[model samples]
Target: MVEAALFDLGGVIVVGPWEGFATYERENGLPEGLIRRINSTDSDTNAWARMERGEIGLEEFAAAFEGEALALGYRVDGMAVLNGLSGELRPEVAEAVRRCSERLKTGLLTNNYSPMASSERSAELAEVMGWFDVVVESSVLGVRKPDPAFYTMACEALDVAPSACVFLDDLGVNLKPARAMGMTTIKVVDPDEALAELEAVVGFSLRG
Candidate 1:
């Protein structure tokens, strides 16, 4: 009965930036998770949120995020922290997307910041993005996940009802709204396990 499969780009389809954050923390001698703590403190109104919503440019975000960290008694470099967001793609997840696209609608729902320049995009990423039937980015929509409006927009884009969608995200916060709206939700902690669960729902083999 699932007509669409919705996925989150970071943490689910691709490797997440947590490892980068940890490395940054170790190199800077900052307290562990200090950057994440700052971002989560006023999540809805934080600099990270504003940047992802495309309300501010990268330079502005760097200053504002650094200021926020300083307010928390930590002198973290926001620009360096932002560098942690880039991660390699996960092939298994990408393959799953291709498989899902063969039979059902696939949507890429990502909360991401606008690239500083158009040249920041890569051919590889562009190719992977093509696999999605619909792509909804928070930077373009002015709404991010955990906001039901974002999920609603994605479903509407795919022309599917929420009850007929299966959503996957690494964050429970992002998945909660979708679940409440009647979508089947999966939290992707381990790629293999998450794909296993997806196979059960879609009744298809995502991994070869």
Candidate 2:
């Protein structure tokens, strides 16, 4: 039986900005997949992981990201790119999180940058976050998803064994590691399906 529930923020609690890359591409007149190429070329050179790890400040992170984009032929507004990558909360998933939080221990485990707290739009998401028992944001914790240390920190914070936690993440890459750590995992492709899967494991309906 599960003792706790852990959720990822982007693509799970909220719908991510699906058009971010396209928008940047359109603005910069870059060919399709340029962003992917950049990502592939320098996996650890970008500001994202460092920002999430709290190793760099927001301004520094933005400057580094913008510099990288400029090098990639994308002369774009860095803040715009960051804002474009975020979107409104997913109501179904938010409701499910609310329901779960009311009945059992709940936590949020997300890979995010430091600027999230300063974004005005983040206040909207904060309302939903207030419902969680523990919030393990990578920006604050200096750890990110797909890393065993991140999952270990979350498990420790919630006072639950990895095997007793049900973790939901939108990315299979992130979920794979959590599963390997003995946490029951769900890859959230569809909110309804995700809730159904959680209901199956937790033996309670989160839809209502």
Candidate 3:
């Protein structure tokens, strides 16, 4: 039986920041979908993965991103761009996490960077993450998901074997490694459906 549930913060627990990127792109006079191009390009040496892995600090990341934008003939403020991309918490998901935490142990497993320490963001994050029994952030751990080590670290911190935990993430790529490591995994889409799927796996009603 699953003794704990691990959740990804962005996309899973909160509405993703895609809208923010759309706004940023529009304001910068860049072609629509520039963010997608940057994200999909292998040539873009500074991707979110590097930041998530703690391989680069925020200032370095912003500078590299700005350099890339300039090289592409897109002049814009990279810090403002990144701030726009950070997500907002979903109240329903926060409530679900609280209910789950009260019934069974719940934890957060997010691939995030140092900007999470911002006072404005921290207060918002605390309200959502406070519901979890253990919160594992990539920036703090110096490791990221899809890497077995990160998953192992989360399992260790939660004091649960991989098989005893149900892990939920919006990205299929992130969930694959966790499933391979013996954790029950859910790819979140619809929040209610996600809760149902999680309940089925863990054999507990998250709604109290």
Candidate 4:
């Protein structure tokens, strides 16, 4: 039986500000999908992973990510892509989290940068993250999603077995590790559909 639910912060819990890159793509005359190109780089050695693991600073990430984008024939201001991450909470997902908390343990598992990047954003996000019983932030833990150990750490933090948890993330790559660990997984492309899937798995209404 599933005793816990795990959520990914940026894309799953809140809408990521993808418009910033849409605007950038329009103005720069670069073809669409530049930001994704930067993000889809080699995960282990990419600046994104390094920054989230607290091994590199934001400026370094910007520079390195830009270089990677250039190599892909897509030029973008990497800082803009980074800034685009601050998106509003998806109300449907938030309500589902509350309901899930009532029926099962909830956790916030995010691959994010250090608090030093933005004290204000960090402080504000912490208030909303209070819904979760356990929050495994990559910056704090120096580990990130897609790493088996990161998933294990989250399960340990929530004091639950991986087999008893259901995890959700927008990216399939992130969900793969959880599913491999025997945790049921959901890829959250559409909030309503994802919640509906969660409802099916947990046998409860998470809609509010």
Task: Provide the RMSD of all predictions against the true structure, rounded to 1 decimal.
Answer: 1.5, 2.4, 2.7, 2.2
Per-residue accuracy of model 1 over 115-140 as CA lDDT, tens digit each: 32242656677777888988898898
Q: How far is candidate 3 from the true structure (C-alpha RMSD, Å)?
A: 2.7
Model 4 residue runs over 4 Å out of place are: 116-118, 121-127
Off by over 4 Å in 3: 43-47, 70-76, 115-119, 122-125
Q: Which is superior by lDDT, 1 or 4?
A: 1
Report the lDDT of model 4 for residue 8: 89
TM-score of each: 0.96, 0.86, 0.85, 0.90
Q: Rate the local accuracy (lDDT) of all candidates.
A: 0.89, 0.80, 0.78, 0.83
Point to the candidate with the largest TM-score: 1
In terms of TM-score, how similar is model 4 to the real structure?
Answer: 0.90
Can you write out model 4's per-residue Cα lDDT over 1-208, one digit (the tens) per residue? 9999999877887775566667778877877776766777787889888899999988998999888887887666878777766777677888888888888999988888865234555544555577789878888888888899999999998899999999999989999989989999999988899999999999998886
Q: Report the Cα lDDT for residue 18, model 1.
A: 80
Q: Say which prediction, candidate 3 or candidate 4, comes out ahead on TM-score.
A: 4
How accurate locally is residue 57 in candidate 3, as Cα lDDT from 0 to 100?
80
| Tens digit per residue, CA lDDT, model 3, 1-208 | 7788899988887776667888998887788988756755653245566777778887887887777777777776768877886676777677777777876778888877763555355565687767787878878787778779999988888899999998889888889999998999999888889888877886766664
Superposed by TM-score, candidate 3 places the C-alpha of residue 172 at a distance from the truth, in angstroms, of: 1.4
Model 3 scores worst on lDDT over the 10 consecutive residues at 39-48
lDDT of 2 by residue, 12-110 (tens): 888854457677778777777666555545555467667777888768877887788778767656566676777668888988888888888999998
Error of 2 at 204 (Å): 0.9
For candidate 1, the lDDT comes to 0.89
Model 2, TM vs. native: 0.86
